[model samples]
Target: MKPRPLDGITVISLEHAVAAPFASRQLADLGARVIKVERPGVGDFARAYDTRVKGEASHFVWTNRSKESLTLDLKNPDALAVLMDLLKNADVLLQNLAPGAAARMGLSFEALHEKHPRLIVCDISGYGDNGPYRD
Candidate 1:
């Protein structure tokens, strides 16, 4: 088999809907280990968007393929600690959470840089990090 460019890279994704998950799926396609962190219970809300594909949400299935899924309730300290531990070996952290949510959870670039200096942090937001429309 041909070697993939991202064979040794690992991506930890806290994402949903379309954009971020699709991006992570791309990384996974390139041979990265993409671990998708989803909310507990219902997982990504997009999973329930509609069951158009044999009892699965087409939107979620389209974007979330080729990745491993993990359920974590970030509001809980134990779950947060588990995520932080996972970051220890992750090469990238990708999130499309509401603006400031990741930072509030101590997953911001600034907050994590000290510990995971080599880890790349990607935050996807509709609006820029700061603006009247940011929410």
Candidate 2:
């Protein structure tokens, strides 16, 4: 099989549940580095959606292989600072948050791009970022 085109990119994902996690994992399978950022204590909610696999959430293991997990509470100043430091080298930022969540945390594409001209941001939402249902 052909290696995927994103072989050298690094993806940082602020995601929960399913959609974004699935995509980011596929990226990692194809040689990308995926850093999954979750909140402290709770982690990704999907991790507890069920315990159907070896005492772990089936969804969690399936979409989180070959990736690094980091606990971050963006609302926390110290954590935000650490995340900002990481953006210094991130090639891509992938997020699937509730409406306006990214911007609320000051992690919007426009915000990050002002500093890193080459950083790519993909905002995943139940609805597209600016369509009906957008915040």
TM-score to native of every candidate shown: 0.94, 0.88
Considering only N, C-alpha and C atoms within 3 Å, which residue pairs clash in candidate 2? Answer: none
**Candidate 1: 10-residue stretch with minimal lDDT:** 126-135
lDDT of 1 by residue, 43-88 (tens): 9998988899887899999898889999999999999999999999
Note the Cα lDDT for every prediction shown.
Answer: 0.93, 0.87
State in Å the error of residue 23, model 2: 1.3
Which residue runs of candidate 1 sit more than 4 Å off their true CA positions? 131-133
lDDT by residue (tens digit), candidate 2, 22-51: 889988988888999999999999899789
